[model samples]
Target: MSVANSVSEISPRPSIEGIVEITRADMDRVNALILSMAGSNVELIPQIAEHLISSGGKRLRPMLTLASARAFDYSGEGHVKLAASVEFLHTATLLHDDVVDESALRRGRTTARMIWGNQASVLVGDYLLGQAFKMMVEVGSMRALAILSNASAVIAEGEVWQLSAAKKMSTEESDYMAVIEAKTAALFAAAAEVGPVIAEAGEPAIAAMRRYGMALGLAFQLVDDVLDYGGSADALGKNVGDDFREGKITLPVILAHRHADAAEQQFWREAMEGGSNDDEALARAMELMARHGALDETKHRARAFGAQALEALDALADTPVRSALADVVDFCIDRIN
Candidate 1:
């Protein structure tokens, strides 16, 4: 199906809100923990880390960690450490991603690599990863370490896989799903799962939270791909068509390419391989995607993943935390910037 047709087939869901309503104390504690954990001895390393860390981010991963713990009725302070750990891991990945993608802007600000150079970004990324592990050890839970270590490995593997798969016309939905699940969903799953584990919740509850995180992560990435094509530059914090220019085959383009005929396929091939930014070429590609309904199809997949994320919340009793988590799924989908 084409992107436009896929979008036309599904009714839009209601918007959810109130994702950032944690108590002042909880916010302060998490902030302090993140700041302390991000601190470093090497001046340049700390500077580079701050360039990205201090930049405004939604801090969604840490929020997931906190929300999961609260949903399980955890009243203890340990969630702070775990939340900080999750943020560290996330920041580390962003640093590396900017380097790998040669991204100049993130969150409407210059990326660390853009400001400090790739060498510094890479080293600081490594430092942040090391600090994350150290924080995990301080948590003194072998289980936490095991979970985060596995997540880190999966994230690394996903990054390598994505690099290897770049611009490959043969890339399929299954392959794309694997890469997103590994790179994006793994950390989210680990972040949510850690909360239940720390609270000593049973396997069923942990699994439910993991499902929620995984689905949410998938939804997040799918919508992100859509935004790359359709979002505004100011809203998205980067130029539209950046992904196409980078020659990365995200879900929408991949789906469209699949349905395209021989001539259309040749257009995609040249676009992916030729690095041409001619407006006429881009418009032609967009028109083909619209005609085939690939964009809409990709949106449907994103919505389905979001619905699954909400369903996972069924295991938890109604609470502000669960409501916020549900809201986050919608926010991921509808975010204009």
Candidate 2:
């Protein structure tokens, strides 16, 4: 049963908090399961895991899993397990990300790698992946396991690809898009798809969920990119210009580079590629992005993807859950607005 065509008929967006409220009970279960599964007799293992897990964030990925299962009317406990697995996968990635990025902060607090050291962070991440796979196995769903495992591999490839392409002036918009699709969107698609698969929802439903998540994830990351240039530190939970400091080749940089003249291009090359990214340089970069309307264009692209996500939601029944999910698309894009 596909409702893709009815997407245009759904009007108004709900609040993100409302959507979260709808899944609160299920999320509580997922949280408890996460805590239980993260435990190990190894002291540092649990310590690191607990540090990252207990830190404050929206927990959007696992919530997506739970809400997706609810949208499909799944009544079994399998969705709970899958939601925990999704969170474990997400947490593992964050641990590794901080190490790779040499990031000191995450979600307005010190990164696990910052306090615990890189080695402990990396090993704990591996432990979480081991636990994620175990939970997936416990679900008795081979297809769900395959989807998540494949996403995990693709995400790793995307990370390495981004590293190789970082701060390269020649990097195209398409190249960056492909990287985000894999690194950020693949797990989202898998997380949402697993819910319906566990529910034995048909192929069409699975496809719809995948599309919805893919588009939402794209919008989510694009907004994050925009926020890196424009958002306040309080809103971002990390310092503004983190992407600039890291020389990440995000969409804003790609757009600005395309519009820049030779001298402006030289500025980008020095600031981003040559690692001359001091505060003065970052200020100049922001000026360039504003001058070229890079931030506006990136937000426009994010809205386009947000619309795609909403359209994908039409494949499901026209229920409050679907409506709330649509609101999530709005909420993600609204971060930049």
Candidate 3:
């Protein structure tokens, strides 16, 4: 059956405590390695890197690696390096994203780009990617290295693809999905898949982890897009309408645009092109979204992906790791509840 079509319902409110507690020991080592790898004599490199790395974000990508590996009873050290590499890849993307978005805050703190400058932020991000590749090479798994490296390329394409789609009313739902899958889900898939490969888990388990990660990534992005329109500044670590102001065509905006009539379409085009960017425009956007059921439909799709993520776990042994992975899905989607 199709994944989304097979989804039934979302689980209850979830907590990160399970995953964090389960992976505590491994995560400690991963954190140390991340810090060590981020070090550079340039002074500004480590300074900017540490500021964001320690900015209290969940570090969810690397945790996915740890959990997937531990679930398979991996006993070696490669998972640690792989986990840290996953984190480095994610952090590099964030630094680049902040620079591209001209963002002022991340996790409610001044962004690295804002604290240093776009030039510094971009360079430090490149430095992190270099560090990420170094960690992957140290792991000595060509398969894992290929997977993560491919994801790096794919994420770059996703960013460019999003720019192409930006501010264009012609953007489609498929275009938005493609962007999220490449930009967000690809890393999640890679982060999760590398764990099983390092553990030497069979093809079935490895494929299942990749599927799980991809679904989870899509779910995370969907919920994130919903938050852009409806969540609080404290919740988002930035303004609620940041996506709208940036002219990004997220799922909510895509759905709202897809369903609009002649005049409604004109309003959407105007707002998307930066002609309308005030509170009144934002309120009107919200009103149109509500009228078109855009937010509700977006949440529905997020729940479906969350369900797929939880379902993908059935391939693995039932244990704390599996339970925690399930909870992570809940953590991603239940916040919108």
Candidate 1 C-alpha lDDT tens digits along 21-53: 753456578888777877777788778877787
Q: What is the lDDT, from 0 to 100, of the residue 213 in candidate 3?
A: 98
Candidate 3 per-residue lDDT over residues 1-337, each given as its tens digit: 6777566554435798999999999999999999999999999999999999999888889999999998898999999999999999999999999988888888889999887899999999999999999989999999999999999999999999988988887888988899999999999999999999999999999999999999999999999899988998887778889888888889998899888999999999889985586789899999999999999999999999999998999998889899999999998897798
Which candidate model has the greater lDDT, 1 or 2?
2
Q: Which residue pairs in candidate 3 have backbone atoms (N, alpha carbon, C) closer than 3 angstroms, thus clashing?
A: none
Q: Predictions ranked by TM-score, top down?
A: 3, 2, 1
Where does model 1 exceed 4 Å of error? 1-17
Backbone collisions counted per model? 11, 2, 0
Highest-scoring model, lDDT: 3
On TM-score, the leading prediction is 3
RMSD vs true structure, all candidates: 5.6, 5.9, 5.7
Error of 2 at 132 (Å): 0.3
Reference-based lDDT, residue 118, model 3: 95
What TM-score does candidate 1 get on C-alpha atoms? Answer: 0.92
lDDT of each: 0.84, 0.91, 0.92
Q: Kindly list the per-residue Cα lDDT of model 2 for residues 289-333, writing each as its tens digit.
A: 999999999999999999999999989998988888888988898
